[model samples]
Target: MDELTSFVALGDSFTEGMDDPGPNGTYLGWADRLAGMISTHQPGLRYANFAIRGKMLQEIVDEQIPLAVGLKPQLVTFCGGGNDLLVPGSDPDALAEVYEIAVADLRAAGSEVLIFTGFDPKHTPFLRSLRGKIAIYNSHLWSVAERYHCRVVDLWSMSVLHDRRAWSEDRLHLSPEGHRRVALRAAEVLGFKPEDDWSTPWPPLDNEDWMTQRRHDLKWAREHVVPWIGRQLRGESMGDGLAPKRPELLVFDGLGSAEAGEAAWKSAHRA
Candidate 1:
């Protein structure tokens, strides 16, 4: 809003750009893509991203929200509560309550806030069980957005994400293409005319036998799910020692390649 001279993004792995690896080994998610687009129009746009992987809603509110508000950005995008929904016995209502306070705080700080709903996980293997919970959380997110008058990026209804190819092997993070689509959708929500269309259908897929699919699921469990459970049991987080890729509001000059942007970001933070 107001030409978006400065912007900050807050959330978890999704906002951190998981599965969408950059050349320099960092994740470059939709927020970075959207910032690149904004920079094209406003070449000197200042932006920062405070997202880290495996962050819960409460952690995001506690750690990232204050930093984002202190930046005094013209716009801020937030997407959280997903990691909380993945945990057993977590309450969606309770998460939404805290989430609402974060939104209110940012809005009160005079920043145009953007929010996102959780994606529909029914199509993902081993994740269908949490579909009901995610739906509940999404509903609460919509209500919060309405109450706060914030823009909403409705990921739950983005049918393109239902395709298997849109997800990473972990089934939790989005694939590179998926992240690109999300960026375009975010641009649309912000009333920007994005070059690509998020709704474009993927090429037709070949059918796989049910047994083969089951085998794939088993492999996925061994490769991804088991490790995730192990980390949970050990009370470890993926972001244990990681820092945000972009920590300060600087000119978004390296919009073309996230790798270049990341290098510049690292240099800026180092100084």
Candidate 2:
């Protein structure tokens, strides 16, 4: 309530940190790093990551939303829906519905929602073939965030236009290095910074257990996050499957309603 006492992260692999291809992947994603930095300044805050690797809008609404509310933290961050665009024969309408549901839930929780914007599909190999659709999808995100008055993190603009090197091996998600940069940028934009500097490289994967864990983590992300994005982009709702089936109809459908700000908090991990 005062400063960010609690922080939550919701999203897909990008939010999960799928950069390191090695088996042991600790998901020190950008959100985690951002929390770390905030903690440096705030010290006693709580950090919760509700992110699932391939989570869709519905998944966040279903799972992450409740967790966020229960956590009762002050800050909630969401970065998602990338998989929605990657799936072949995906539906955008469903994706939007799911997103709306998630946003509604976040607002209801009184969170300072930060939605990361998507970039051009051309940034990735698969999406390269769907450039036009990517623009439409990103535009929809901007419009939706504006409607909710949620804080928009221009990841699309920052990643593609300003810092292209932020992408990882897959050219889709952010690399560990990219996540570090993003975390720092978020700190700068939000005016919060911890003692530890994430600009340097984090320790390398030192063991098989770590690698195995990382591999499992990444696999988990690919499964959940991607499908959700696909569902949303296709214009279908994941919960009841009754949402609209067209992206064009995304407009004028405020069949929805209302919401929620900010604070610095203690660091989570600074070594």
Candidate 3:
């Protein structure tokens, strides 16, 4: 309710900032964008992100949660379980049990928690199959937020994200513009009026015929989907041997340009 002096973000690639590439070739997704907005109001807000590209729910609970607890930030945003839900036989009910424990831990540590639902997958041809599972998991997330009194940013209801333009070429992570809109949504959830509105409609585009759509899907399947399946078969992850981008709750001022943001990121990494 009061000014959020510090924040920590935890989850997988979505939070790790995939397709939304920053200058210096790193990802700067919604969390970084949100941090910048908060700093505009608080002036010296401290923030950290413990998200990697391919983490599962259990990994986030076991690894990132404790670190987030240690930081004791005023706000901590939790988004996990999408990766687990993508697994062939994962159960949403069981995932929520583990998810609740992490929520409990953060709440007990006296931080206001912010949580997110998985973005609606119905628009993505390859990911549409997981819609039911994601919906089930999202229902559980809503219940968890209710029980813990946490703030929620309902990604599923954001009609803007259903557009093809909001996604990256992989049909997975959000595009830079997509992340920008999400940050604006998160700001609104926190009761702040952002500079831009998330609900603004995009300019019109020519419709792709069925054959053209099929060709694009096939190309994406070869470049992205097949390799993802191979990784699952061999028990490997894209984030293997990688570390959290922002491990400490360092101060964030939210630089304007990608170049400026990258310079600050490098300075932070050097520290």
Best by TM-score: 3
Note the clash tally of each candidate: 0, 34, 0
- Backbone clash pairs for candidate 1 read none
Off by over 4 Å in 3: 253-271
Q: In model 2, what is the error at residue 66, expressed in angstroms?
A: 1.8
lDDT of 2 by residue, 63-136 (tens): 66776766655677776666666667766666766786777777877777777777655534445786666566
> In candidate 2, residue 161 scores what lDDT?
28
Candidate achieving higher lDDT, 2 or 3: 3
Scanning candidate 2 in windows of ten residues, the lowest lDDT window is: 254-263
What is the per-residue lDDT of model 3 for residues 1-271, given as tens digits with 9 covering 90 to 100? 5777999999999998898876566788988977876775677899999999999999999999999898888999999999888889999999999999999999999999999998788888778898998999999999999999999999999999988899999988998888878887887888776446788899998999999999999999999999999999999999999998888889874644755344222211100
- All candidates' lDDT scores? 0.85, 0.58, 0.86
Ranking of all candidate structures by their TM-score, best first: 3, 1, 2
